[model samples]
Target: MNKSNRRKFIGTAAAVIAVGTAASAMPLSTGKENYPVLHHVFFWLKNPDSKADRDQLVQGVKTLKKIPSIQQLHVGITADTEKRDVVDSSWGVSELLFFKDLAGQAIYQTHPIHLEFIEKYSHLWSKVVVYDIIEA
Candidate 1:
């Protein structure tokens, strides 16, 4: 390429890199706060594709919002995506719970609302996996 073309190409590449760096530096809304505890649960239903089962699980998740200790609750279904070796698409529903701290999570575990939710909806899922995380 000519010198002018090379310079233009270099400038464009630098601009692209700068834009990407700026975007990455911006704060993302992952909702993690200092010392917050996140409880993530993935459920595989006995009938994974059953709309009724999914609806029931969603309802049960919503009920947990009654517990004051919970900072946030998000319920969602598996996303549609290309099959990949590392992706686990077997789960039918996912529940994300955010608690202010470990104490808040401890209270949530034994809260009546939480217990009722489990008692009422435990039968819907054949497999459940829970991952708890604490922000540093």
Candidate 2:
């Protein structure tokens, strides 16, 4: 290749590297305070089959509301979202809880209230999934 071709290739490579680096350096926002350690516990449930199942889920939410260790508790079906391509807003029910720290989260996991909640709802649904996230 000639000098001009080599120069053009180098310039294109540099531009690509710069763009890639900039994108990597940019941190995506979680829409919440960047706590040193964050525990995100999620649960997905199959559609309820009976009135009994629905009733039991309600009892589970009520039980969670009574737990002091559960700083926040939410239970409901996902709402309609206009931005369907950017977000997932579909599920049967969800419960959200906040703790002071990791220790608090552990405590919540073993707390009697939580145990009772599990017992109450475990049979209400056909499936469940949980995700715990700890971020720095």
The prediction achieving the highest lDDT against the true structure is 1
Per-candidate TM vs. native? 0.74, 0.55
Which segments of candidate 2 are over 4 A away from where they belong? 1-43, 49-52, 83-86
**Ten contiguous residues minimizing lDDT sum, candidate 1:** 27-36
Please give the TM-score that candidate 1 achieves against the real structure. 0.74
Residues 34-87 of candidate 1 have per-residue lDDT tens digits of: 547999999999988699989989899899999999988999998899999999
lDDT of 2 by residue, 1-136 (tens): 9999999999999999999999999998887643333344334455544545565676576676675655555565555657667776544566665655677678777888878778766765665656565664
Off by over 4 Å in 1: 1-35
Q: What's model 2's TM-score?
A: 0.55
**Residue pairs in clash, model 1:** none
lDDT of 2: 0.64
Could you tell me how far off, in angstroms, the CA of residue 119 lies in candidate 2 after the best superposition? 1.6
In order, the Cα lDDT scores of the candidates are 0.92, 0.64
